[model samples]
Target: FTNPDSTLLTKAGHHKLCHYIALTDAFPLPIDKEEVSWKCLVKGAHRNEEMINKLEALEANSTLKSRVIDYVWGAGSQLRGELIYKARVAVPSAYSLPGSVTEEELRKALNWLIQRMQLTHPDINAKVCWPVLYSFAQLTSLKACTCSEDKPWQHPIFPHLIKTQWWGRKGEAKKLGNKEDSNPFINTPITLMALVATAVRPFLVGLNIF
Candidate 1:
């Protein structure tokens, strides 16, 4: 999200998605792009501010391919004191795919999966929201959304995925899935947090709904 002067975009008062996307140097090549064929383009394909900074670093450096965000409970905390109920997170080289992988090979292998899902769930044939793609070092996106259109006949695939995460309330996470705990936190827990991405939902919810 660096600006033209390399200042972070969030510094500005107003910015559109296009503005941030411009920073990433990404272009559209969706699963359904018809003219060129999705298969030809994506032979294989594949989060946070500190996370974002980390990925950008990896993408910049050709020598490195991945990094790790260790198990912790402190990300949401002001002091980041807690360390219970956690999942290890990997910071992949999102823009850069790793060695020993090729797009043609991944497309051929995943073709069966794509076809099978379409055949098995004909309902999704229109929606086209299955087969979430997390791919090689090179096969990654800076940002994407994957929520469906919900209305039929519209493009079913929206881009809403990046990593695999497990979320739990603080108490349940404290318990770490133990059955005996008398109290399990019930609300949506901050299993993951980003300086970007999740801000607008709460903003709109407060402005319109509440």
Candidate 2:
């Protein structure tokens, strides 16, 4: 098992620490070897290549950042894993899709996300919990995909959705578990700056689309 590079480990650690507490509580369960392996990695049992890749990708991906941030802010809000899975699949596939993602692809992604959550959060009651989780990912992805390279950043839709993506839902902030004294407001100065930067990022692509 390889320790991920610092940047990746840092992001993964933030996710594990901030968003996966309940999932962490139930791990290394009695299951087949592959499932056990998946569970181990999800629980940080042994950092292997796949784990490193996931961590690295998570760190580098701006799309994942907002969703992860939102998920963390809603900690212990009693969401079902199924819903989360739908949202996860929706984000990437939607970005890749020419149009909105199809129901079939969304379903497949939901299945994939279920497996991921099972490996990471075995205690999750999938059948009942998935819908709630799906809503989060769907909304986050919908908001994020508004500014893809194919779309002009200056488009009204891009700014509006990106703003929602940046600000997120103010009501969820209390669940983040940050030290109460330093809890961030929905309109934190830094967040506002970040929103501006993200909104303007599309203009920079004129220099290099890649």
Candidate 3:
């Protein structure tokens, strides 16, 4: 690509050492045709592009994905996909709503993030547009909506809920996620032994209004 003027084959040599290991006796091919094509490319030089054409020319013999595919999707002890950094998000304080995001702000925030990250290379500056512009395009359209977010701490918002969400139980609120969380003698005095309804008890302890 650095070359000011070059032919298609000019950059071909660099791509020569690429290898495509889509098929082995033990491991079956994954679902992506592009991956298989690129995989074929790395296996050998001239053999690479042949796989690309082959991928386009023929229909894939579809098969169930293997365990290897599953593991990569989310292997042992590891979480999967984007928003691996899921955490409670607060709306920028400047906005009128104290704890929640409006529909438009939410849309714009998501749109900007998706575009900045370039989640899809082919489609840059992807827009999170509405079905009908006239629906919510008024000057007063940005009216803030409040969230009765009783459980703000566990909000696996957006993609987190849609694609990835998790649940956790707690015995004592004061106790951190450590050995003390479990041992009654050490933690009971600090914050009495919590009831079995762990989800509700902790939520009621320190909420704002009452």
Candidate 4:
């Protein structure tokens, strides 16, 4: 664990410290290395404003964009590709993910979709649009998605999920047969807003996607 206010590592350890910061900043922790195979590699991963800027500017076409966005969201939002994709299957939300979708697959899809959209609407803001679409896809499907016994929950896996009523429209809570509200339907718009608000703003500005 890093001391919040102090430097995690010395100047000589910049490269090493960068990785841990990257993990902490990009994903929710209490992460178990054994569960995922790439744990060790991430230990010394580089992270910085320059690196972040580079990543944000890499490309936002459907394919690469989707993968990058998925990685970013998956890390920070604490979602897994299989889980999110499965949710996509249950509803026609912000974006679509067929049963076969993977982080790699979605990356390709987003790259193609965003490129086509950009050609016709050059004024399109890829940064905001990319995540917005992803969120839309996730939220629409969230209303009807569920996890299996082996599935991991970003939050806690509970028996019941309390879906918030959209637009204060008096929506009903669907029962997943548990006492806890584990899979609640997140407010899509708010989720989207939060994502856009906290994204690396300078990077978006550089891409002229703000």
Candidate 5:
């Protein structure tokens, strides 16, 4: 058993343990050309090539058809007419491993994990909604599609709403005498307004008053 917190395990020990687990559990090896080349030089390139080709054939035969989206929603909203956006999301660091793999393979694996979460978790699905709105708004703003008209959420009506919300929050932050709380939005009106507009659009669409 590997103990992640154990002081006895040096960095190299932890890495070797991870490598053993990856190999034994048949996880995708981390892309490590140097390590692969070294192994090939020691064990003979033909033998290594034969093993890799067999693994590739097996992977091709068993590849799943499902796909996953690469992004997540950053939930932003208004509270009591005050603009608020969620804290920045933190992505966990990728596990360190050594093996040969392409960028596409890594992307596919990550997306697969996301798809699994979306299938099994309702909370994650709800959190994803705002980011989807953000992405849509960005694409529409950039005129990435053939649709020529502006989205209802992108109209001028919402910026006023956002500005009002922001000033209200600024007042509240001042009353609380907290420098940290007040400073976050002090010079961030434009950025905060954009996030607020993105957050508000979905609800507006649902209300069907457009």
Candidate 6:
């Protein structure tokens, strides 16, 4: 269901809603002729008409514009449609990597997803959170690098968590039928639970905040 809160109209909220739609397969084709097509879901979520117009204009030149159009209009090839469907189904699990992922790695992966989303929906660039998310990712990366290893804080299996986590579980990468193998990094989800847990764990020490 569409979010009833007016916050859905904000740029950040709009992008979040878009991601929700993708992850949940919520944008179904209209059953009745009078009902708006799935494409209008994105259009209707925007609060600012002028911004939407500007974004629509700019989207014509975006690198991901064609794919976005194809996804929205349901005009992609059979293979493309199947791939999109599979990606949506896999998104929720993509957040859970096999090994311990550092806060920095999690944040970087999340920011990468957000940036990719913004590219898919250019209107999200209007949100101030865009840069805030980027800065947070960088700060987390720096913090992770500076932490002492006296307690063996770094994960041994995936010491370079960011790179390996994005590439999926080692040696378990799935291959599509008859076709060449997919990129190991392509299906990974940037999960929020891991990021939140990692970011808050240090603060939870000696305090029963649960």
Most accurate candidate by lDDT = 2
Reference-based TM-score of each model: 0.17, 0.20, 0.19, 0.17, 0.21, 0.18
CA RMSD (A), model 1 = 22.4
Tens-digit lDDT track for model 4 on 1-210?
Answer: 132211221221233222232323323343542223123223322455443343344344345434433333333333223223333332222223344545544444445433332211212222211222554375332222122323322211111111221112343223323334442233232342222223322222222321
lDDT (Cα atoms) of all candidates against the true structure: 0.25, 0.35, 0.27, 0.29, 0.30, 0.33
Q: In the order shown, what is each candidate's alpha-carbon RMSD?
A: 22.4, 21.1, 21.5, 20.8, 23.2, 19.5
Return model 6's CA RMSD, one decimal: 19.5
Model 2 weakest lDDT span, ten residues long? 119-128
Per-residue lDDT tens digits for candidate 5, residues 1-210, read 133321221222233322222222212234542343223222322345543444344235433101000000000112312332221110111111113434434343334323332211111211111112554374322211111133423433343444454335554323434365544434443444444444443332332222
Error of 4 at 57 (Å): 42
Q: Which candidate would rank higher by lDDT, 1 or 6?
A: 6
TM-score of 5: 0.21
Model 4's alpha-carbon lDDT is 0.29
Clashes per candidate, residues 3 or more apart or on different chains: 17, 9, 7, 14, 4, 1
lDDT, model 3: 0.27
Model 1, position 101: C-alpha lDDT score = 39
Report the C-alpha lDDT of model 6 over 38-137, residue by residue, as the tens digit.
2443454467665465446435755434333334334212323433344343333433321345554445544543433321211121111212355437
Candidate with better lDDT, 1 vs 5: 5
Count clashing pairs, candidate 6.
1
Cα lDDT tens digits for candidate 3, 66-152: 221232322111221111223212112211222353465455544443333222122122223333356667443332222323432
In model 5, the Cα lDDT at residue 176 comes to 35
Question: Which residues of candidate 1, in runs, are more than 4 Å off?
Answer: 1-98, 113-172, 175-177, 180-210
